[model samples]
Structure formats: C-alpha cells, structure tokens
Target: MATADPRLRSRAQQQQPAPVAPPPPPPPPAETTPAMGLDGSGDAPESSGTSSDDSFKLKFCTVCASNQNRSMEAHLQLATAQLPTISFGTGSLVRLPGPTINQPNVYNFNSTTYEAIHKELADQNTQLYTQNGLLNMIGRNLNIKKYPERFQDWMPGKPRLDHKGDQGYHGTESGVVDVIFTCEERCFDAVLEDLHNKGGRMNRPVHVLNVDIKDNHEEARVGGQAILDLALSLNNAASEERKARGETGWDRGSGGARQGFDEKVPEIVAAWQERWPTLPALWSLAWF
Candidate 1:
C-alpha cells in the first residue's frame, strides 16, 4: 500500500514520520564466473611479463618440433599483430628433408643460422630444395629470425638476443612469456615436460596451449591465422581481467587476483575452438 505524501500528512503524523519502504533489495552482486587455477600453490611468478605488463599483450612463445613450419608461421603472425613473441624447436637438431627418404640434412639448432642453411641447401641443389619447399621455408624464416632455437636450451629469464646482437623482434627483453602455443601435441608435451623438470621457480602462472596444425607450409599458414585469432581473444580477455582486478598485480593477500585471467582461459579457448574447428586445441596452466 502506498503511504500518504508528506505534503498531505497531519501535523502529528508528519512529526512521527511515515513508514519507509525498505530500499529495493540491493541489486544482486554481479555474476562472477571463476575459472580454476592450473595449480593451487597460491604463489605468483617472479618474472616481469608472466603476470602483467605495460601493454595489452600477454607475451607469446610458439613452439614446434622443428621450429621451421608451424611455429615460425605463428610467430610471424603474432609479431605481425605487434605482440611480443618467440619461437623454438623441440627436436635435438634442426632437420630438413634431403635427397632421399632415409637421409635428412641436419644442423645444430642453436648454432645453425637460416642464411647458412639456405646457402648450403641452395648449393646442394637449388631446384630440388625449391621443389621440396625447403628453400621457400628458409627464406621466410630468415625474415623472422636468425636461426632455429631449441626449446631445451632456452635459458629462462634471459633477454632475447638474436645472432646479430640486436634485441629480439618487438623486444622480448623481459625474458618471460605469459603464454606458450605449441603447434602440435608432441611439442606441447615437450614444453610441459621441460617446464615440469625445471620446476615452478617463477611462481607465476603461464598458460601453455596447443593448436594441432600439420607440418606443412600451407597448413602452417592457415594455423598461423587461427593462432592469431586465439591470441587476440586471449589478449582482449587479459586486458579486461586486469581491469577487473584493478591494480592488484597478480598477488593479492589471498591470491584472489589470479582468477582474473585463469578463470577466463577455458571459456575463451572453447569459444575460439568453435570458430576454428579444424584446429583442435589443448590447454594447460603451467609456470615459467
């Protein structure tokens, strides 16, 4: 029932006051859908870029068995988006197809430069390597970086320096990444296993994800686009995540800030999978 207006209230009733309707029930608190953390240690990483950075990007590292086909393609796409990125190979050495099915040209992953491989392959047989697409792959790699780097040998927290002594493309000087995208399952396993062996020393959480793309130039290109799309989705979420958490940086007294990003990861990937059904993905929460 409505109460009488104050203007019409009798003198005594006005002095007594009218009954006040309870304030409409406080609007229900916002729906906060929390994503699970990869681990329950409740510790944040010590590295500079793993958790938060000055820019919108969560730095990216792309990995593949050879680092020639899929990883490089993804790296190119990520860097093209102005995202800080690096690429690595999981194999013992860089291998390229040679004259026969049984024979493969091999080079030290860390020491062999793309120019050296391209020149040597060209010297061996330009027409054959061209027909095989090795030359074209090498040329593409040359524009991206100096050589194939082995993930096993990557020194965590060390600034990225190319063979030419310049800082890595877009300055990976932070020596840390917020996410890793492996081109296939084996490479994803290698990355996780390597991280496991290294232990979670950084205390920061890094998302390791896999997009299974075949090892071919054309497939790599298609996968690169897909990877870029995923990166963008994750990047935008990260920005919102940071905003929601305010400036808490990844470490609140009770570790509440981390949920900002971790909670959104699975949802984001699932949505991305819908758009790119051809490229199946696997995700894990790992550390630096």
Candidate 2:
C-alpha cells in the first residue's frame, strides 16, 4: 500500500505458505502380513485356492533297472526317513541279471519274494552272488523292510501295476508322483521317452531326474543318500515357492506350480550332481 519496491513485493509473495506434500503415502499400509492359519502357521488363510487338510508330504518314486538295488535302496532310505515313496523298474518285467551275461532271473516284482530269490540264488551258486556281494546286499534289503513286496513294477505311462491295485503309496492317485529319481542314465532316458510318448494323457505333472549312479551295493548306498538329500532340497524349495505365491498348499492342478517346479529342476539337479563330480554319471532333468 505504501508503494513498496517491486523486489520487496516479490519477496512477500515468495514467503507465502507452501502446499503440504501429500502425507507421504500413509506408509504403505504397514506392509500387511501374509494370511495365517488358526494354528499360527504363516500359511495363507483358508480359501478355495487353499486347503486346511492339505498334505505337505511329497510323494516320490525311485526308478532303476529292476527296482531291486538302486531304487529299492533309495526307497528304503526314504521310508526310513518316513517319507512317502514308491519304487519302480524301467524294465517291462522285473529281471535281475546274474553275473554272467544272458543269465537274468526274471520275476514279477509284485509277487516274487526276495527271500525265495535269495535262497534260489544261494542254492544255484552261493559263491556267485556271495563273492560278488549281491547276496549281502539282498540280505540287507530284506532286513531294511518287511518284505520284497515293497518293490512295485512301474513304467512311465501306466499306473503302477502292483498286486494291491492302482493305489500307489502315500495315497497317490493313478500312481502319479511329484518326482521320480532314476539311478542310471539309461533308465533316465527311458523315463523321458515314456513321458514324451504318453505324458499328454497324464492328469498331473511329474518331474523326472537322473543321478547316474553305478548299480552296486556301495554305489546304491551313496546314491540313496544323494537321493534323500535331493528330495529334501526340492521339498524345501517347493515350500518356499508356495509361500511366495501366497499358496497355502501344493496345488497339483495348478499349471503355474508345475511350471515353477520345472523351471527350478535343472538348477537343482546340477547342484546335486556337482557334489559327486568324480562319479561317472550323466545327470539330466525333464518334466511333463
């Protein structure tokens, strides 16, 4: 009003109060905690996408030539650890080849008794298997489980043809397994081929991995331990994935879950195989 200088008037205008800065976004709602179960587990809340009665236990299938040595060993190890598992043979029929070529003794995995096989082998030539350490391994297998009935015949496409019918271990429907660990490269190839040829018909996803171990007692022992380690690693990884996806349990029907598993499988198999670098083995992975 007193005809103040133009500079002074500009200063007065600049001194007026500035607008507030939008209250800093309300601190992002405190990053809401993930839904939880009544038992206090950090699982997603009950919903159609989640199940409270879900079984967290993973079902495994071990495949080797005859399901007698390598697969059986891993099967027993899994059983001892109280994991749900089943064993299979890549062969159309269970046939244990003897030390001599063309001397395989064929038997049905579902019906033949290990004891009878052992006795027969012993009677034929105790020294044949005894000296080669097969008898000892067979004996150990018998002691590990109640009977040879623990072994079941399985191919990739068909449901496990067991005497007990199609009910696979751990209540798996149609003999579907979350993962199948093969002991040798050939068996691994067989599984992949079977899956390729018939996987489209499968209702659930299956992961096939090869560890490529020698088919012997000591090797079987080593392979079994390795398989157990891999199984645990996979289970842990899968759990973390479910949590990240906000899933309360494994959704077998979810293609996303299966894809996630398939994505991580190569890395997991490579890491596990790296531990036994000196072993003459071919490690590979495939899923369908």
Candidate 3:
C-alpha cells in the first residue's frame, strides 16, 4: 500500500522468473501420422504382406567328411529335436579311414548300408575297430537312420552318377533348405564353394553356416548340441520377426523374404562361440 522504492520494485519485477515461456506449445502433438500427401493416404498403409508359422519353418542340412560320423551324429540329434534335416558327406568319395593310413574302407554313400560297413569292418579285423572304437561308432550309426549320402549329389545342377551309371540320391532336390550346417572346416569350404558355383542357378537363397568340430564321436555329440541350440534360437527369432510384421500362419512368401540372416543370428552366433571358446572351433555364415 505504501509507495515502494523504484529500485525495490524493479528488483521484484526481475525476480518474478520472466513468465517461463509456456513450454513451447507441447511440440504440436508429434504429428501422430506421417505426411499423407506423399503416400496419398493419411491412414497407416496396410502391411503389404504377412508371415505364417509355416513360412518360418526352416529346412536344414548337415555335412561332414564321410557323413557317417559327425554329420550323421548331427542328423540324429536334429531328428531327435524334431527339426527337419538331412546329412551329407563332403569327401570326393565316401570312405572311412581305417586304423593304418593304407587301409581305407570305401563305399558308395547312396547305396551302401551302415550295416554292411559295420560287418565288413568287424570281419576285416575285429581287433582293429574294436580297439580304436570305430566298430562302436559304426554300430551306433547303423541304428540312427538310413544310409549316408554325399553333398555333391544334393546340388541343383545335373545328377551326379555313380560308376554303375545310376542317378544320385535326390533327397535334397525335392526342395532347397534354408540353412546348411557343416561340421568341419573342409566340409564348410566345400559347401560354400558349391553354393557359390551353383546357388545363383537356384531360385531361393540359402544360408550356410560352419561350426568347426572334430570328426569324433565325442566331438560330434558336443557339436550336435551346439547346432541344435543355434537352430532353435534362429527359428524363434524368425517367428518373432514375422509376428512383429503382422504375419500369420503359412502365409506363403508374404511379409517379404527375410533380409539375409536378420540381426539376431550374429548375436546368437557370438554367444554360441563364447560357450566353446577353447575348442579350436569357428562359426561362419554365408549366403547363396
């Protein structure tokens, strides 16, 4: 009520916080929807496609040198896990290295039965394989599945004929797999080379991965478990991506084929590698 001093009044006015500027009008409600004129619609554009569970169903192939040891072990493991898979040998010819370097046992993958090989090995010198555990390995292989096969025979080009002039097995010809897991470094190189030479000829893309594993029973078992874990992780990631993209079941190539291996596969691979860091193992992925 009393007249305040001019300096005091000026100081009071200066201390009143300068009106706070009203927070810049709440940023215009963030646009809600993108510009409609560019795409010709204000409504969110409907997804061009959708994915189904079946679309996410992946086919797998496993490869090793002879297809009787490492690859077969992985094949049985994948089957036990209920994932569709096939196994193949990357050797120029299907044969097993015997006790001594000179005593090699050769067989045709498509026609030879594990039973026959086991019998032959057991008869040659029961003490040979029996001492080194080859006999038991062959025995276990016999009960797992059908006869072993070769990877060259699975190529998309002309049929690989045996000396008897018979067409090679066409198990893989029925459909191309989404992924191939090779058990050793040599097999891995063989698969990638084959794919590079023939993949462009095929209509679909394939992802080939290598998990360097020793060619022994124990190593195969360890490798098989690793492969199964990686596979399940991949399948789940694919399904989740499809769902996120609004895909449904068996959508038949809707949702646009996945972009390469997607971001999750590398992370999963790294974790898997870390799990077995000391095993002289390597994991690599290639597209074809």
Which candidate wins on TM-score?
A: 1
Q: Evaluate all candidate structures by whole-model CA lDDT and list the values in order.
A: 0.69, 0.56, 0.57
Rank candidates, TM-score, best first. Answer: 1, 3, 2
Separately for all candidates shown, the number of backbone clashes (residues 3 or more apart, or on different chains) is 4, 0, 4
Ranking 1 against 2 by lDDT, winner: 1
lDDT of 2 by residue, 87-127 (tens): 76776566765756787877766566666676766766665
Residue-level lDDT of model 3, residues 166-216, one tens digit each, is 111223334456668888667766766655555455444455677878776
**TM-score on alpha carbons, each prediction:** 0.77, 0.65, 0.67
Candidate 1 structure, TM-score to reference: 0.77
Identify the candidate with maximal lDDT. Answer: 1
**Model 3 whole-model lDDT (C-alpha atoms):** 0.57
Candidate 1 displacement at residue 153 in angstroms: 0.8
In model 1, the Cα lDDT at residue 253 comes to: 14
Across 1-288, the per-residue lDDT of candidate 1 in tens digits comes to: 111221222212100123233222112111121111111121221111222335656678899988888888777667656677888999988888988888899999988888788788777777677667777677667666778899989877776654333112555775778789999887877777777666656666778889999887668777877888888888888778777666465532114445767777888899989999999898877666
